[model samples]
Target: MESQTVEYKSDIPTKHKLFKAEIVAFLNTNNGTIFLGVDDDGTFLPEKVDQYKQWESWISDWIHSAFSVPVQKFVTLEVSAQNFAIHIKQGDKPPYYYKDGEGFNSKGIYIRNGSSKRRATDDEVRRMLKAQVANEFESELSNIQESLTFHYLQDKLLDNNIVFDPKGLRLQNVDNQYNNGALLLSDQSPRVTKIAVVDGLDMSADLLAKKTFSGSLIKQVDMTLEYISLLNDTKVSFTGAAARVENESYPSKAIREAVINAYAHRDYSLSADIKIEFFDDRLEIFSAGGLPDGLSVADIKEGISAQRNPNIIHVLDKINYIENFATGIRRILASYKGFHKEPMFIVTPNQFKVVLYNRNYALVDDDIQSWGNNKLKTNLSDAEQLELGFTVNQDHNLFDDSCVTELEKRLDSKDEKIIKLLRLNEEMSRKEIESYLEEAQTTVYNRLKRLIELKIINKRGQSRSTVYYMKANESK
Candidate 1:
């Protein structure tokens, strides 16, 4: 639980100054509940009636006079047996203090982080103050055509045939004081500034292949899907001693999701444009924004959904362009159900990117086959293969011997995807793998459970929506 959910005690020095400091601490931390009038040992014994009234008055008087911050919003209460529960919520305003000429003197400015109310270090206080000011000056945009429709999303994205309402989209109940609203809804969106994309493996290539999407949000949606379609439909030929081979890794859903997330979660406040770049071997989507507050690519397994643009998310979820509060990173990992190569993510100071590589090719079908051949090898059935080709051909990349050497360093030989994914890309999602790798859903779950047991990965979240990511063997 966040710091804001505490059972209070009279043992907490209800003297005026200390009481005010504690209340301020709770607000700074996670908004928490405080129980008043309860003795240290959980007894319901009330204080003397006269003293109780005086204590209440003292509490009220100090709160009004002591804190420069607004007390009304942060403090909420309920009472039973003279025991009270006071709720203090986390505030957007920071560097808030309990005052009276002794500015941060004995009761220095404190911040609640996790469960501890530590004195705010200079850096923490500065960041909080900057965050407050940055939040206050967010840009606002007008002239959005209400009738502008995203019907075009349905036209270009073929793998998932979803429909949309002709009516435009809106983000309701957004706390404008803390959110960057206009940048997300603008027609140019990520296109306002020039976009650049790069291969994760090769960061220095100025002339690398890149594409741009133009027009309204609907038009941009179409443009992005059009680029994704090129990847989905592209085929590369590989020649083997056995025969000639053609490979098409057409899991369009994965590309769509990566693109959608780039648009939906990217920090539009930044000047950089969104980018879709295809490397010789991988496809990458770069969004200006890094992961939202308190989230990282590792959070893929955590199954946490923190959208930078809830209004945009609202419309995307409503029209089914994206799943409602669904985690996209998890879905991308699922796309590699029968394959060995996993997805990757790279996070930089102001950007977050998702990368998917072409599936590795194997010379013979059996060569790429997993340990279990019959029950779970490939998505294509015998009849499907027959229809696909009477003369099947195959080819494969040279085995990555270095990965094996890296693997041997492990005390135990466990080949879990979540582990493999982290080794390649620190952020991999178990839920995403489950969603895309539908055939191996149970197998993935079991593998994750075993990894967690072995303490190779840490599991978080609840139910079928849980997330799994790498954990140090010693960390657990």
Candidate 2:
């Protein structure tokens, strides 16, 4: 028997190019398949023998040499008559582009955008290119003594808190002119490579409060975390219904490791900034690069050291920013385990995002209440729900603010009926929700009140009116 999975497409030409781009995009970004010649959209164009044979040859030719690198593509027949499907799978090397019968096509590159084909933007193209480049630590940082300002770094470290011997941190070769620069660990050295804070709705220039570090990367990291701490306001609840609020879940050590790894592993040649997203519940740090070659998520867990930037690594070592030679990831995991939660380290082509989930001790003591007649679907606490809400809000590509808030509140209140309704249409307002459930305004308002108090749902608008919505975390 033949494989059931194949690339399926309708008779729509515009959609065909989009699907080809989608298949190409999936091959470029991660890996997936695209099927063509299927009549799912009711445009069942019968396959002709001569035309089918010609198209097959053309597709084969396109797949082999039409991309920056060859992506996998396969064509096969369906079980039905005159119907067929094509499968375009992803390959190991990413950032694949099509020749476009002339020059390179960037926007034409398609990726799976939730069951649809969407073109990649210019930013995505640059990210892909960075991912494709092979980075070796020793080879790049060999001539750092000559290439960068090592003396200035030493002075900065002495002036700051980093008490280390400069001789141990100096680059060996003084002759080579192309060595990667180093990061100093001094009180004056700014450990954060970059800091970006966005206010209001969109992540636009007007809403963004961005800052760059001029000192050594180590100091910049320290300064960035200090600023992040200022934004973190913690609130704790007790079994007696008493609430204590302060700056908690601010795991300084875990954050320091995350920043160190980000600075040490970032692709310096790239222009994107290191990202620090501060919200009400949690913080997200995104380094502008990914894991080094031959290193996977599993390898990171193995506590192996494959330094991507040797110059920066050497300087950090001297200052004790890195405690163990090969135990950064392990330490981070262990720290999170202590809190009864897991720290997330995500690997993207152009970014490494870390999430330090909040553990509200007070909320943990209380038993989880179900929504809609006691359907306990998730094992998340009240504080976890708030963290999930923050995660959903910040992740714009996944959901909007309203969706996440609603999901959390419904889960907390044991309102299962509303939870399913929100799952189908996340943007539903209080009125729409009332209409859908055929309930009274007072009931909906009371449910929404419970949600807001729990931090599961956030209220937008003002006066004698409002919109009640769920957060992305609620869906989970």
Q: What number of clashing residue pairs does each candidate have, in the order they appear?
A: 17, 45
Tens-place lDDT digits, model 2, residues 1-476: 11222234553364445435655755654433444454554244665333566556656766677666654343232333464455554444555666666666675665555555567778766655565553533235433243244444555567656644434455434543333443233333323355554332234422223456656565576667666654443443332223333325656667778777877787765666677764323467887777754356887888755666666676666666675477777777876675656888888776778877655432433323323312232455545544544110122323344555445444543354454444334345677667645567898778777656655456567754765556643554
Residue 422 displacement (Å), model 2: 36
Q: Positional deviation of 467 in candidate 1, in angstroms?
A: 49
Score candidate 1 by lDDT: 0.54
- What candidate 2 gets wrong by more than 4 Å, as runs, is 1-134, 137-152, 155-172, 176-178, 183-192, 197-210, 234-247, 338-341, 360-476
Once superposed on the true structure, which residue ranges of model 1 sit more than 4 Å away at CA?
1-31, 34-74, 92-109, 129-200, 204-208, 232-251, 276-284, 290-307, 314-320, 333-349, 355-358, 361-476
For model 1, what is the alpha-carbon lDDT of residue 133? 43
TM-scores vs. true structure, each candidate: 0.53, 0.42
Global lDDT of each candidate: 0.54, 0.55
